[model samples]
Target: MVIGLWLASLLLALLTLLPLWRFEAWWVRGLDFPRLQLAVLAVVIVVLQLLFTDLTQFNQWSMLLISSGCLLFQLWWILPYTPLFSKEVMATAADSTSPCIAILNSNVLGPNRNAQALIDLVKQHQPDILVTLESNSWWQQQLDQLSDSYPHSVKCPLDNLYGMHVYSRLPLHNASLQFLVEEGVPSIHAEAELTDGSRIAVHFLHPAPPSPSENYSSEERDAELLVVASSVKDVTTPVIVAGDLNDVAWSETTRLFRKISGLLDPRIGRGMFNSFHADYPFMRWPLDHIFHSSHFTLQQLQRLPSIGSDHFPMLVRLCYTGRQQPQDGVDPDQDDKQLAQDKMMAQAVAPDQVHRPETQAVP
Candidate 1:
């Protein structure tokens, strides 16, 4: 029985390191979760190792291997908590009062027919801007009533998963939808003129997830996000980028995106606002996010009610101050972080790249 326990402990320790392999298999991706589970298993292995010290006859070399594996797994488990991986930024003071702009991001399931629930949610919040993803022609028409309330609009209704629509009460100057990653995947880029006369740049995206039917790998998705991050790096205007990133806030890629873009995540010091898998709350991660440049301050962030969609909308209100200045104690060299993001995006957007699909604009 002692031999069996030792072998079992060794197997568990080895299993914890499997996620380190960069593979496209579902089993590999599924292991993205359960880091905590692996941590617990590592602890159990250590306890077993200590208890079995008396059973030296059971292959000393095998026991040494198991102990070393457990130690490595323990180190991997705590890596995320390290400061080098993720940094927290505090909200800064702003001169403008009442500069709040409320934004709602919702993914209306393409096939779901209940549009009234979504309309009701919008009515209840009355946000300054509403961005809907996975919207088709039918979904666009269903939301036509909103045009009267929000005079400015940008709509791209494609059958592809990247279909997107943006409606805003604020004037959207030079607003255009661009496919930064894939041909049909649209991202809205515009200068929003706030009620207080301050201009803010906003970018909205809904990149396709890495999956067999969508794409074989996360290269395209990751690269596209890097492109967006790089574009907003040195802007003088207050900037806000929000969407369903399809990545958790804790992921290494997301952290790199934040550092590269020089954007502030509301989730810092705040809890993870997991927005996906509303049906299975336990399995949810912070997929929907609102990231802002340091020029703005977070006024409010909340999860909206479900409207017959797989994703619950995220509502964030940010107050724009004046442009950040180095003399004012704000770091001027912050834009340097965009270099890595720019390099990644440039490589991903190269003409010969096969991961990104051909983009098609919707009429």
Candidate 2:
């Protein structure tokens, strides 16, 4: 019994410390996703140790201390998203003439043939802008009915699973498709002209994840996000960055991206809004995201019903005041900036240079 307790405590401690290392390996970086799960594990282990183990000994006491610390750390990272903490994004009244825009971001699993369900959601919500990832030519044909409602669009349909399409009710100017870090993975950048003649910059991305089948490391994904973040760091226009980042909201890379870009996540202090893995209720995380500049105030944010895809659609409605500043998030320190630079440089190789392995239908 004592041996098992010690081993369990040691394992929990190691898991807590693994994400602290700056490595981009799938295992190391992937540790960032389950902070809440880790917290629960730590609490349960601490309880078991206290109830069953003899803590009179020095080593036993030390183990308890380490486990307690792990619990605290995990909670610190997670509780901010719960109701216990104040909201990060300010809420205000929304009106049609005041630059209010509703956006829906969905990662329609490439092979999932349930188009009617997604189409039904689109018709029901009637979002002003829709961003779909993993959308190929077939998905395009299924979603073509949206063009009648959303006149402005940027489409890049590819079979490689990184295809993307953005449809907007507002006018899109200077709409360009970019292959930031990887060629097959495309991103959208454009200026959206609102009904009142106001404009905001919109950047849509669906970066690859750090999995054995995808880029072995997070170098390409982190680089793609940071590269886009860096480009808009000094832009004066209101900005919105949306889509499946494939990274968790609390991950160090995502936090750094927010700081460098001076953007805000509506999920903070609101809810996890876990969008991916719609099939599994237990194993899920917030892979899709919507980050906007402070000039906008949130009116509504919701995780829509499953569209028969692996990911749940995320809908956000925000009103641009053009005066208010967004809530500040974690600011990237000097070391964080250096880390981003290193990751970006690591992806400097040609996209084709990275071996593309056959992947399952999950993003």
Candidate 3:
């Protein structure tokens, strides 16, 4: 029993420390996801060790200290999302003419067949703009009813599962689809014309997750995001970036994106807002995101009911009065920026070499 306890403690300690390596591998980057779960597990293991074993040996002492350190480290990363830290985006009074826009970001799993449920959810909320990820032609067809409400749209349907569609009630101009990093993975950039004739830059993204089925490394995803971030880094107009980012709100890459793009996440000091793995309540994380510039103050943020997909939809309402004072998020240091550049370099392929076999087939 003592040997087993020590082994478990060592394993837990390794899991805690593995993310510090700054590797782009999926398994390493994945360690950033479950800090809350890891903290709880570490605490429970420490308590069990204390209750069952006497702390006389050197190994026992090491186990206790390591487990406690793991708990503290996890809390350090997670506590900000709770009420302990003040909200980065402040709430502002909004009226009908506040130039407000409500956005719905959903990742309807490519193979999931519950299209009616998502359509119903869309009708119920009536968001001003809706961005759907992992949406193929079938899901797009099912969502055609939204055209009457959202006249402007951008659709890129694919079966290889990086498909996306953006629907907006507000007028959209200069809308074009670009394959940011990988040829198959597309992102939408456009200008949204609000009721008051003000235009706000909108970028919608759904980067492919780093999984066995997808890319083994997170370099592509990180590059795609940083590319967008770098493009909009110095934009003077109001900017909003929203979609299923396939990343947690507090991750290193996400933080770097915020610093690079000068965008603000409304989730800070709000809640975890875990929207992924909707079927498994215990194994969920916040994958969907809606980030806006300081010009907009948050009006509402919600994680909507599951539409039979791996991720639940996230809805955010922001009132764009003018460019408010920029709020602080995780400000990336020099190392962060360097790491982003490294990831981008690792994933950067020449245009002639850009042909992915999966992307060759007509969708």
Best by TM-score: 2
Candidate rank order under TM-score: 2, 3, 1
Q: List the residue pairs that clash in candidate 3.
A: none
Off by over 4 Å in 1: 1-98, 325-363
lDDT of 3 at 262: 81
* lDDT per residue as tens, model 2, 1-363: 778878988999999999989888888989999887889899999999999878788988988998999999888888877778788888866443467889999999999899888888889988889899999999999898888898888899999888899988898877778787887998888778777887778889999999888978888899988877776666666888999999988888998999888788888878888897899887788899999888888889999999889999999999988675647666778988777777777877333222111111212
Error at 121, model 2, angstroms:
0.9
- Per-prediction TM-score: 0.76, 0.93, 0.92
CA lDDT scores, all candidates in order: 0.70, 0.84, 0.83
lDDT of 1 by residue, 143-203 (tens): 9898999889999999876789999999887677787767898888777778877777788
- Candidate 3 per-residue lDDT, tens place, 1-363, comes to 778788888888899899888787899989989888898899898898898777997878888888888889888888878878889998876443577888889889899999898888888998989899989999889888889999999999999888999999998877778886888988888777888887787888888888788889888888888877766666776888888888887787888899877888888888989998888878888888888878888889999998888899988989986766667765667887777667667777322322121122222
Give candidates' CA RMSD values in order: 6.4, 6.1, 5.2
Best by lDDT: 2
Candidate 2 Cα deviation (angstroms), residue 181: 0.5
Among all windows of ten consecutive residues in candidate 2, which has the lowest summed lDDT?
354-363
In model 3, where do residues sit more than 4 Å from their true spots?
A: 56-59, 94-97, 349-363
